[model samples]
Target: MITNDAMTVQDQRTSKIILAIAAITILLATFAGKMPSGMIGALGIMVITGFILNYIGDRTPIINQFFGGGAIVVIFGSAYLFHSSIFPASAEQNVTTFMKSGGFLAFYVASLVTGSIFGMDTQTLKKAALKYIPVILGSAFFACLFTGLVGMLVSKSFYDSVMLIALPIMGGGMGAGAVPLVEIMSGKTGMNAETLMSQMVPALAIGNAIAIVMAGLLNKLGQVAPNLTGNGQLIRGQKAIEEEDQSTAPLNVTTLGVGALLAVTMYFVGTLLSSVIDMHTYALMILSIALIKVSGIMPTALEQAAHSWYKFVVGNLTPALLVGIGVAYTDLNQILAALSPMYFLLVLITVLGAVFGAGLIGWMMGFYPIEAAITGGLCMANMGGTGDVAVLAASKRMELMPFAQISSRIGGAFMLILATMVVQAIA
Candidate 1:
């Protein structure tokens, strides 16, 4: 029999080879013209291939981490290089446009509706409603106020770029709710939704990357931002743990039925509410689903359903939208030319402003220091998107890792709404 050590070595080598193949395939697919019907197919294959490789690496912990991180770095880096060279002008626009179109809409709606149907209960719903109301409303007020101040200080183009930055940050931070708000303003104002979305996606992607980087930096800085005690820890800490436990629980028919019922109800409610609110129906659907899960009316099966649904929506459905955005890239050079010196300044200001302000607020409120860093990083990510936040978070490490992920997501969502309102006021 093959020695265990030898077998393990072989597995590692195999895993690496597989991942490398996937990486090369993704690169070729991204740049080469003959692979698929359109950009959507190309992106779909790339994302799917990446995820699949990650999934296969799951059994081997070290290999998983190494390959997963490596894949992300390679793919994202190549994408950036590709964007800069081939699609520079319209890269950003392509992302924004994909985000604004029905593709994103479908992705968000599906995720929210399915998530609500199976994931939430009335009690959880009520809590989320209560929690988010103050947070979102406060964020909206502050966002609008800030936008006004910025408007007074900046040019129209500057304001436009700021809004662009805010879109992905909001989406990543707040979830799908922010997308509608971004889409609405883009559509009404004729902001070249496609172009804006394209730009926003890469920006967000870059921002997420930045957020990840910042996590490492914050740990090194040892700024001692804040630390939540038992209560806060209990509230936030239970999430991942609870989710893990939930995953192990068995699925039952009754629970599944109830979850389905609730999901269906929320979908309709979201649709109905969207007509009146001028917000994304997906947002309302998510809200509705949260209510169902929190209420505790459903069986435990609903939890599983919700998880599956979220995976479907976020993982499967959203990628298509991403691809659509990719296809929208017709004039990358124009986008680059549009980037004036002031734009860079604005980017800096926005990044620092959100990071310091939000980080300080989170720290003072007894959040973890890492969470505080994430809060800061989120200001950049939500406006930019996941890529930026990832960059920011990855730059840091240790305690900051959780914070970057959690706080940015929390803040990004809130800010998306706020940013949308800001654009509306300006219009």
Candidate 2:
């Protein structure tokens, strides 16, 4: 009979050889400028790269401690990798298309949203929905106020700073937040949208990077000061937290399929409702899910299945999704180009202001300060859905995804309306 220890050694050797072969293949394709194309090629590369970089980030000294560990590496590392000349341009385009047009990001987020909301206590869901918006409002108020003051001191243009820089940075991502704001400003000020976009994109990029870093720092803070954070729970001293079922049900393939169906169907419903309503599709989806949970309409087995499917996606696909985000959304070049002492300072203050405002208000409403700052503040400051994923991943608080989506979708819409009013007032 073969010894167990010898068998283990042989298995390890086989794994190493396989990894080495894969690495060599990737290198050869890179130098030859002949990376495979289409979904198969793009997804394969992203998954391999994500896993390798994630491993390195987790093992590296100091990086795993202060930074976001593997999460940061998978994102920023992939950003640099995709942007470098050594990487094939065709490959980059393929990855981008797969991430956006393929609906991979939406699929990932819908699963998280549905699962997290369904898994929560019904009463907790009700209380969080009622109080979360106020936290977002608080975050926006402080972020704008701080950015405006600093802009006046540095550039002597408070209106420009508040309108151009602060609003866009806190308004969500480029498409939903900055684009609409620019068009509204164009109508009021007679300036071209292109010119306004040029001015705002840098701030948005830098702000997103800052928010990601802050998320990592906040995660470290939670480790040192557990009292300030509720771990993943937003509410403090809630019975829901105490009563959470620690023993999860065994994995059921059929149940997971049912969960996937429910999640996608809910997203479809959101899309339909959005066509008739003025709200964003994501916002409508969140509201619909929350209502379903509150109404006790969904069966217990289905809810558990949704939660189970969520766990599976987060475990297996998160690194791959981060790779996609790095390739599609993160623009390190833009961030570097916009870096100045004064500009960096203003962006940092704006993010900090958001954290402070949300934390303070959330505490008053019986939510944990760190959790509130992350979901309510950083989510708003980041680059919308992609940013939400990166920030939440860095913070190691994927369970709070439902709240993060609320900040991005609903809060983003509010910023658009606020921008319209501000433009009408100033113009």
Candidate 3:
């Protein structure tokens, strides 16, 4: 009982206990047809549970890590298991009903507004924007161009399939951009939008699982790869960046609040403009950024809001989206069974291509290995949406979380514009 391994044993026991509690609670809720708000309650529980576990873990490192990982596995694994059992009755109907419920629209609007308001700077923020605006704009432009070209070559039908694949990637990875793309393709091509979306819901869930595994593997690879480079020269730039970051002032609450407000304002403004101008969402995003910058409001507010918004989107909204998907899981075997091979192939190609390309480009740009990997994820998410990017972004330990946020927003805006233009051209 007093052995050195006692702690390990206790940790395992604690993890199992938490997992069991979660599994049972989820099962009861799901089976009783009482799963609250289309898995919204479930997602909230997961987050709250995760936070509790994390807090407990902080006190006991071994237990913390064990339960942290175990809790997630249990929650998701159990949800999937429970969902599968009850899926036969009305998967199609359930998913369609949820989609039409407009949960996603609300989530998107909230995220956009919150992100815009929180993304802005409060103090001397405008100056920061002037400094970083070019870099952000340039990145967005290229990312859009790249995503558009690739999305076009892949075929409209393929785009539809990729959208499906992108969803799970987003759900698990926090990639939101994929959903809109899927919707756009469905609307433009007269495809079976609901059926396609239903097929994607499961794919996204699977993608989320895969993204977790991939993130771990990539993180390991990043750690080991740097060792191969000559001693000293390998991480000079990275070290320099880190040192530079350390010297900068830390973000404060008022600044953060102001940023959130600005991001929120921008979201509504952008939405309004989109409805009136009939332009692509990405175009609207870029226009919003431009207006915010030129309005003498200081780009920093947007930047800060963007940062806060990213956290909120990833931590809160993203999980809610997943729950939405879970609620939509009614069991549509017949529809999924009818999916063409081309559709599957297109999805696989687009995801792999985007991931690989983003990584390569990030690496070429001299970004840290983790940053590069995130960039790859962002590329996929941006091309697809937030769900995919969040998955990729989550894979790495970032030195600066804000960079990932800005990169995602900028990249997504660019991709949206590019995708829309491509669709328009083909039409």
Task: Give candidate 3's whole-model lDDT.
Answer: 0.44
| 320-425: candidate 1 lDDT, tens digit per residue | 3323323332223433453555544443344444455554444444333344434344433443233322333233221122222333344445555566566678
Task: Give candidate 1 regions above 4 Å deviation.
Answer: 3-32, 38-40, 43-45, 48-81, 84-128, 136-277, 308-343, 356-427
Model 1, position 402: C-alpha lDDT score: 22
> Please, what are the lDDT tens digits per residue for candidate 2 over residues 1-427?
8899999999999999998898779757755767777777778778888899899998988778878889999999999998895577877888899999989899999999998888888888888889889999999999999988989889648888888888898898898999999999999999888989988999899989889888988899999999999888899976456246413634788978988998899899899999999888888999999999999988878888888888889998999899999999988989999898888888888899889989999999899999999999999999999999999999999989999999998888888999999889889
| All-Cα superposition RMSD per candidate | 8.5, 2.0, 9.3
Taken over the whole model, the C-alpha lDDT of each candidate is 0.44, 0.89, 0.44
lDDT of 2 at 151: 90
The clash count of every prediction, one per candidate, is 92, 0, 52
Put down candidate 3 lDDT per residue, 316-418, tens digits, no spaces. 4443343333344222343355356554444444345444554554445444434444434533333233333323333423222333344455555455555
* True-structure Cα RMSD, model 3: 9.3
Query: Considering TM-score, which of the candidate structures 2 and 3 is the better prediction for this target?
Result: 2
Q: How far does residue 30 in candidate 2 sit from its true spot (Å)?
A: 6.1
Q: Using Cα atoms with residue i matched to residue i, what is each candidate's TM-score against the true structure? A: 0.54, 0.94, 0.50
